[model samples]
Target: MLCVEFFAILFLAYVILSLSFERFLVSRVKELYKSLIPTTSYINSINQAEDIDILTSNLQKLNSEKNLEIELLKKEQDYRREFIGNLAHELKTPLFTVQGYVLTLQDGVKDKKVVKKYLKQTSKGVDRLIYIIKDLDLITKFESGIASLDRKSFDIVEVVRNVFELLEMRASKDKIVLKFDKEYSKQLMVFADKDRIQQVLTNLIINSLKYGTERGVTEVSIEILKENKILIRIADNGEGIDEQHLPRLFERFYRVDKTRSRNQGGSGLGLAIVKHIIEAHDEKIFVESKVRIGSEFSFSLTLNQD
Candidate 1:
């Protein structure tokens, strides 16, 4: 009877312990699952699993996912901080410029020539502020999905020529020769937002002029990638960018040489705008650069079937 009773007691204890183990794991799982903040997209799957093996597996996966998410959030936070700081500095510089000129003029200068020059400078400062504000507005629209492309079949070659003609004087002033790789005997048609594509072309050619050396050549080329793909390339023989800066080249206000870029007189949001425009069109834009050789910017457009 004692042996039988001892066996029964052992069975009872095993059952109780098994029940207790499950409750313990379930409660602890709830605790850890609760600890995860919603900064990243961790799936909310709670497994009140009775099996120890399954429970442990679930916990491990959750922990690993949370750790990765936390790291991503930290990196994003750093970039956000940098972007905010750069934006503030960009706005402040033009504001101070306008203020200084305004105050100088307010002091009642007698020279007509000096007053005229100051007024011109003040106007230029105002123009810069306007450019920044307008570009910011455009980017915000693009980000929020308010901006859209009115894609249509158009002659890409003709557009390129028009842009070249429009910027011919500016290019000439900088001694930058704008030309095509080869003459197009017939119109090369592609489907895209004509106006936005023109804007992209304008911004890229202007960028080449801004960063390129005097007498540099800015060349445009078109290639047929496949039956459906048409590639448009704008290449420049300018001071090429370092590989390190290439990744963030399309980011707003990202300058390799901040002072020189500022002096170059652009909104500093040109590349950012160009990126958004291309991305919105569901196409990718790319850049290839060598430190001293030069840089080439390219994007593909859909070849119009009709």
Candidate 2:
């Protein structure tokens, strides 16, 4: 009887110990599994990642962004080089002309007529230099956001009429008729910087006159656009630009024909300045042209409600 009791007690003790060990082993296994996997609320630092696919995806994205940044830097460097080169070229022409004329006078030219002629030419060169400098300053101000606009309500129709009158002599010289598409009797008031808007109008109309065919018609038109906007367009029956030229046409000093005449005498920054002015007003400018057909430059403005 004593031997049987002892054997039973030993069996019970063995079973209890086995069950405790199995429960402890299961708890240890659960902790190991948790360490191997990530929880939904887990976050990893930049240098640390638990999942291989997530690491690969993050690396690919970083590489793409780096490549994009490098490409942009390359483009910007090229553009800077081009802009500097163009500026030098534009300034050199007038500078050389003025220097040549001044040297000729310094050589003691005898005839008053010859001296007067050279002086006049020298004066023209100086004027051109001034024009270029002013345009450059204006555009720089615009690009740097240093320019200020005196925004107010003004009659746009009167402004166009005034621009036409101001350029009347130049237009008549080439027999280019500068007129409105239709007569506007009532005032078409707009909210903008009056002087700056005038400058925009003048530049656009001047471009039409300069590039238009002799005796071609240059017309200004204004139409009411939706959302309290007004559209102004300057159209000319001129030698239309090629399709490719229109894209970079507003770029400063960009020319369709590099060999085109400079005798037309412009600062070459007109379109660029016009673009800046319009954009400064939070507006967009557009151009359309067809070879051998014509070109139209247009922009929109906020119509003055009051």
Please report the candidate that would top lDDT against the real structure. 1
Cα misplacement distance, residue 222 of candidate 2 (Å):
1.0
| C-alpha RMSD by candidate, in order | 4.2, 9.6
Per-residue CA lDDT of candidate 2, range 1-306, in tens? 999999999999998888777656544543443454446223233222234346456447857998999999999999999889988888899999999999999999999999999999999889988998899999999999999999999999999999999999999998899989987999988999999999999999888887889989999999999998999999999988899888789998877766664778654699999999999999989999987788999999999897
| Local distance difference test values of all predictions, in order | 0.87, 0.86
What ranges in model 1 sit over 4 Å off?
1-50
- State the lDDT of candidate 1 residue by residue for 80-194, as single tens digits: 8987897788889889989999999998889999999999999988998898989898898998999978999999999999999999999999999999999898988888999
Question: What is candidate 2's CA lDDT for residue 255?
Answer: 71
In model 1, how large is the Cα lDDT of residue 40? 38
- Full-model lDDT, candidate 2: 0.86
